[model samples]
Target chain A: MTTPTSRPDPRPAVTMSVGRDKHSHYSYRDFFRFNREQGTIIDWNNTQNLLLSEDFIVGLQTGLEREVGDASAAVMYTIGIDWGKRDAAHFSQWYEREYGVGVKQSNLLFLLETWWWPFTAQGWGKWEVETESKQKGFLFINLFDSMVARTLGDVGKPVCHLYAGLFAGFFTTMTSKELSCIEIQCYAMGETYCKFLLGGQERIDAANFWISEGASAREIARRLHQE
Target chain B: MNSMFAELLQNAEGRYLHPDELESLRAYVEGIPKRVRIYQVLHSKESVLLDRVMEKFQPTLPHLTRRHGILAWERCRRDLGMVWRYCCMAMLLNDEDYLRDKLLYWLETILKSFKMRDECRPAYKLMLDSLASIFTAEESEIIRPYLLLAKTMLVG
Candidate 1:
């Protein structure tokens, strides 16, 4: 860490019409700090200080696999679920403060988009939820340009366990129900885009089994509905 | 120049920063204008500078556009605007400590990759020149030292 310094003050202060806190909104600009002398970035806020280094992310995902062997996906899922729960609790506070405690009264799609805006800012790329099937105990999330999968490339398997865990965790808190999520299609698996299915653990487990049994995303959905 | 500001530049002995100057730095940062005259000048110069920047990065345009889509230039513009805001804030604050912290923060967290770091220097240099062009002779004299300090923070 570099130390702070004092410098020569320039011209006398002039008054401007800008709001004092007008620039205080959470922006990607506030995401990090710069150290001029050391030529490095320092994390800013405590809660929002996570860095977006693709190398670090790739290393972490593969590092977990090296350390835990076959169970790394499960471990990643568990971490993501916990992250989602904590994020939800923090998010709800902000949401309530900004929009009031009216999650139900808010437009559902708009609310979900609001929830996702920060992630987009953080370079997680754009995402959309399949609204019609959300009430049927299952929701589909289409992720365009997943940073994780894009970084890792076409690895030939469903590799977005972090996203799966995040969706599962987010929905579990929002709906007040135990939800599990799994990625049925992944960019790593040579898919054009990444897709996830969020629902009860039983439904997710069935999908996971089908995934292992060589079922396509559409086939998994069709087979699940027919059950 | 204030005594506090003088002490900050002196303390930039190599890469090590002294921790004691934080309080003065905070006060200085708090005093910066939310919007500055430089921002308006830079805002008007943005389009031309962006085009120049895009042309400079034309080699990587295909890959960047493929990954980030056709709005790559737009995204770069938005980020440049954001960074310029921070730079203006640092200029107003006029403390090496404040500028250093603010600059490092942006580079590390926001521009977390090498590709952005590579493009940032030339883009900022162009912006500085553009801002300087709009200054009167006397105004240029007054703003030069502070602006130069900001430039140093960016390039370093």
Candidate 2:
């Protein structure tokens, strides 16, 4: 929790930029403020957040499995969906207030990136939203360093149901449409990263069936014409 | 720099910045042009810089072929380019946390997944060497911290 200081940087500020964001380059200092005296971590949008440990995540997942058995994935997904929906509502309010633009009026890619930055700061890992084939009824979201997959180890199955549900929930609330998301590929399944397919329930269910039939992520993308 | 000013302003809600704070502000203000200049050079020749680093890195990872998954040079191209973008942004922001929070952690995971941790040391050196070849000693000095951070996070 370093306080803001105007002391001459002992070292030269050797940063290089490409003229993007000219004066408003996003920085964590402005975004995640740690107030030690108050013992609080407040984000740019003034949201209070926690720094959850790997052990806590692992324990929560395993505990759910023990309590609900095979339904743990579903439970996680449900939680993510609920969390996502809430985040959308929360995000819209802050976003409009901060940017002086309604969420609906903002550029799509910019809007999504702005929405996800806080999540990245919160250690949910980073993501790429592939909208090349969004018109075909679905899109691919590539997630790297998924907190769940990294902590749970490789269990030979998709371990990002929570992310799937989170995307599912967030999109549903934002779009005012019923949408579903499925983790088509996962790091826990020995992939380099996690990939989620977001689309209508039918598409997600079809992807689920394809996974049950041993379809790879590439195959799923091909079937969906996402390539 | 922006947040620092914001903090000073917040503190000034009742009282003005004292001598110490003004002196601090002078230091940060003087460094802004240097950062912007570094960014200008790096941004103008980013493609050339990236290609140079790749050219230098090629012989080191000989076993990694384009046909190989993450081990391939092709994969490195994309990730390396991405790293460069963030590095430039981080440097321009003149903030180390900008690099770590925004990109390095995610990149470390991606690298580990590809089992390319061994690539960091040489890559870091090569990038530094490339920067040295391109910029003056003073310029390279400023860029070194961010590169060092990338090396540490990706490999250590």
Candidate 3:
């Protein structure tokens, strides 16, 4: 497995003051107070509560670490010759040694760009079946569609809008590599915004669009460039 | 899980209800002379005990007819201030329509009561939070917007 020369600290090292944005809708103190008051809603069995209170925090910490380790493994598996298997143990050890402090699942986000590469390979795109199925199978399609309209600009192609919302929803639920299949499908559908936003105009297949789907990939690329 | 439950039971160190108490509850369930006083006493002193019993009994509750369950749930919802028990009852009944209507009704009552008595603001907030947690996403879509508006007014 290929190893990085150095690992950056995963936690934010520099302390920054919280500042209210000009359009700040809620105050931080009020949010905390709301959460505190909300705590009374659950009738905690006192003894179980006390035991679990500490355990929950520690479990969260460990879960995060495992998630990051998994993400990094995906990255190494993407780049290394044998898909990062032969040196898996050593790579994991190195990651733990280098980034042991406050390393958690949220840190998996740091390895996304690296892990996302192998997902682009031809046969690796089927993993997104669940996300696609969730979108197509659900009856409340408009709820998500409207959310996309509000978040992304309303460019108004139904398929493109659906894909955008699907991307955001999958981002909430899946890992980066798992989401890559949806990204590939969007490319197949000739979604220009999807290509620009997700594929970064690099490493996108220019010939795959017309291979089976409605529009040619080159045709979509040409249209985007023209615009 | 049983060990955990047993440990909680030991630690709470609450009073164990006599055989008479179970008989009284059974009588109440069986539609004998209404014993509001006995229930009130049980609720006031043994609320935790009631909660444990409700948790243990929930799985078996689904087999009961909807009419019977709803009647029992209505009494529990009205007489006992146990939000979790009410939620569990609604879930066990497994009728989404009934669950939504009853939960919303209870929430509206709590909200109205809070409005009538300003001192109940904290309790009202807790009730709303509990309602939000218990209700399904579809149910929440109906209740949440109004609840949020009320919360905003209260916070302000």
Give me the candidate number with maximum lDDT.
2
Q: Report the CA-based lDDT of candidate 1 relative to the real structure.
A: 0.65
TM-score of decoy 3: 0.21
TM-scores of the models, in the given order? Answer: 0.51, 0.59, 0.21
Instruction: Arrange candidates, best TM-score first.
Output: 2, 1, 3
Per-residue lDDT over B43-109 for candidate 2, one digit per residue giving the tens place of the 0 to 100 score: 7877787788888788877767643656567657766677777777777767777787667755665
Model 2, global lDDT: 0.77
lDDT of 3 by residue, A48-99 (tens): 0011343543444346447785353233223332332322333344334434
Sort the candidates on DockQ, descending order. 2, 3, 1
Question: What's the number of clashes in each of the models?
Answer: 16, 6, 2
* Model 3, position A17: C-alpha lDDT score: 33
How accurately is candidate 2 docked according to DockQ?
Answer: 0.04
The most accurate candidate by TM-score is 2
Off by over 4 Å in 3: A1-156, A159-227, B1-56, B59-156
For DockQ, the strongest prediction is 2
Give candidate 2 misplaced runs (Cα > 4 Å): A1-26, B1-156
For model 2, how does the per-residue alpha-carbon lDDT over A44-93 read when each residue is reduced to its tens digit?
55677677788998899899999999999999999889888988988898
